[model samples]
Target: MKQSTLSEVKSAVTPRATLLVIGVVALQLLFVVSYVGALHEPKLRDVAFGVVAPQASVEQTMQRLDELPGSPLDPRALPDEETARRQIGNRDIDGALVVRPDGTTDTLLVASGGGRTLSLALDSLTGDVLEAQGRTARMVDVAPASPRDFNGLSSFYLVVGLCVGAYLCASILAISAGARPANPARAATRLGTMVLVALAGGLGGAVIVGPVLGALPGSVWALWGMGALLIFAVGAATLAFQGLFGVIGIGLAILLIVIAGNPSAGGAFPAPMLPPFWEAIGPALPPGAGTWAARSISYFHGNAMASSLLVLSAWAVAGVVITMLAAVLRQRRAADAGSSAAEAGATEPPA
Candidate 1:
């Protein structure tokens, strides 16, 4: 029997298919909203800044800089230019100004390696303020980025690649075997497999970015180790999601890593330059933590990195626990069902 076009369309798209399409649409819209909202405006918000001046003039300098419109720079008084340089290297502050006691010129110490965009913003803002005071601002690069590391974004891009590799490897494992592992052993096997993938992919990415491309200058061994940790963390989390929610878990992984994690990761703009929401969440997600750690390794002499490393560790631990628990629970349910079926058959007479 021939059917009308509308009837054929209705038959082709079941209720489940309609719902899946709706879910995809929602994710697409969220991706667009998150990326644009985080990057559209690149205004600095309370960037950590230090002022080095004589005791008598330090308070006035701090007050005037603080009073800048939008409160762009969070200024504090430092004892000497030496302290300013040390703090910038420690990543406790982004840039510092050393006000000369004898001359009208002030030296601004900025670390381009932390992020070129952020350092440039610091320069422009400080330059404008010094110009108002009729003093010249001399720019000094305390930790300039490697020439090949364009815009100092290589660290961020490398972490993003690791995250993508993590999820894709986990998804492929799920497709080849099963979304939910049948038992604890199978779940463990999947995790063990992910670790190998992490190691191989991590070393490959580190070598490419370090020696092959010269995109970043850091200890290749340190980068390789961190890369492995990041990949396993993300891959384990994806496996956990799949164990709990079957095929739909892939979407959840994308929602967390791609739509929510990427823009908020501070890859394009540092956290302080992003909006309040993105800035707040960026440090808490995998992509953000990985990006910050990578940059610390490459530029900040591995300073102030304890918190980011802890975050990645937590994700890896949680994923392992959840995946194993889900598989064990599923195994128990199957065993109980099988036992009940056998008992029922043993009591029944021939039919």
Candidate 2:
């Protein structure tokens, strides 16, 4: 057998190759840390809430909430019940207290869909407050999750499925051919396949969420549309990454979706309830946008669905364009190489 060529040896031992391996190992380790750290405890602390009551009662309610044993509630006084309700609906606060004018009973308005733990926390605290004041508390779920939804986690599950499909499909596509497609035709073919996959995945998700699992309730058609777009967007983005950065694209996707997006997605805690950085990034990413849209469609009469859909579409379009462009460049390079090889052969001396 012929000995290995010098070029082959160099390629195998190069620093570039070693660095790539090291980077992958680092990312793999980070994935474990990120997932565990974000999900391990799942405890709530300092949840924002509002108190609405007469001038005299407001001070008493705020003091009671502040004195709760564990520092669970971060209570602020609002001017009126309308403002408090609006804040809860807009997700500015997780719950609110509307002290009755007669002072015999207080209404505890909570958004269970925002976070069940938070709601339960408020309920327990409100009960204690009522008991201390010799008053009763009536619970109201203002932004309630869908009847079919439990723990308000259905949206997270659905979005996660979409993300998994996207990255896995893109990884498969990259492995089948080169990380970057060999030609424009190949790129187009892969994209067509991705589209079909997206559609099927979308429908499957809707069925599972609506009928099989009963984890979500909404216009099935709307959910289907969201599922399709979200899957396609993430998949296309993965494809674009692979086309541009080769196999490292898989690692990049993991970093973006799993490491960064998950914790920031408000899956464990709602956006307003999260820390500043996570809160800011949450809505911009696919997971956050998808969850928000899902909840809105299911319970909010689709009030904010359009904007989220548009964001997903934008990501999809951008990914498609970049992938196609990369494929075109690859094809051009291949054509140039072929031309150069032919020219060299024509000019070669006789053997």
Candidate 3:
């Protein structure tokens, strides 16, 4: 009886199912490793920083900052305080320290709108350095986050939500219909359905963050546009994966968007604060690009957005191309197989 029961269990769990289970376990472990590794220790390294002071002290100040343990700040000599302010607003530099020529007090300019944690880190690091030299500096927020934007994390959270909706909606379409669309028309239709979902999700998110909760302050139309683009980018990519790998593509999409993209998205910590690997890949992913663009629209006057928008656009374009091509190829193969089978039948001797 025991032997029979074991055989029945083995028959019920096929090899294919066993492989998928193993994949799930691997993804689970990766999720833990990625999140903890990127977030467990967010130390600043080579953060873009500007320095303004008398010509004599500029070089000394920059060298002092550059030699700090771990090389926290990448300091450059700014022409003046006005230039520092302009650079910060343009997102060229994360923060700046301006030393008053005749006064003992200096001013640290940080934009909390970019990332609250980053701004705080810069403030503390600069403050400690100045105190060591018997000088004091006051911190000023050049571009502040919206009062309601707690910790300046609302933008990151908003992007994360849109990304989740994108993949979930795409996965649902694959589950309801076949994972690989049968033809070009079906694939196009699937993408069209995704567009509809993107529009709805984008508008809903924009309204919630803008008028409803006031968690973030930005033009509703601009936010709506960005939100729509992000959703479509992720959904199109997910659909493309499904077209190529069938149901397994769904897992691939999760791996790319959730497991790899989220922790590296610079939500709790900015890129300069993250480790080298996560920082490097963060701007290329959907969530990271979306978060950067969202914050720019909200606080930076939409400056420094070209790179992020380009990244999202590339993903959207590539996904669409791959998905359509996959469907067309599948259709052609099916046609060829059917024709060959029919020819073989006709050549067979009549019974």
| Top of the candidates by lDDT | 3
Report the C-alpha lDDT of model 3 over 42-118, residue by residue, as the tens digit.
99999999999899889999999999999999999999999999999999999999999788899999999999999
Clash count, candidate 1: 0
Tens-digit lDDT string for candidate 1 (1-351): 356877888889988789889999999999999899999998899999999998899999999999999989999989888999999988899999999979999999999888899989998999899999899889999989889999999988999999998999998887677778889998999999999998998899899999999988887888898899999999999999999998778889999998889998888888889999999998888999998888888888888888999999999999999999999999999999999999999999998
State the C-alpha lDDT per candidate: 0.91, 0.80, 0.94
Candidate 3 steric clashes = 0
> Which pairs in model 2 have colliding backbones?
none
Q: Per-residue error at 303 for model 3, in Å?
A: 0.7
Ordered from best to worst TM-score, the candidate numbers read: 3, 1, 2
TM-score of each: 0.95, 0.80, 0.98
Q: What is the C-alpha lDDT profile of model 2 across 1-351, one tens digit per residue?
A: 135687788777898888888988998788777666565554445778899888976898798888877666789999988998887766667888888987588899997776666677678878887887788889999888776677788888888888888779878987686677878788778888889888999889988988887777677898888888888888888888888898888888888877778877777667654655666777777887888887776666666567778888888999899989999998889899999999999999999
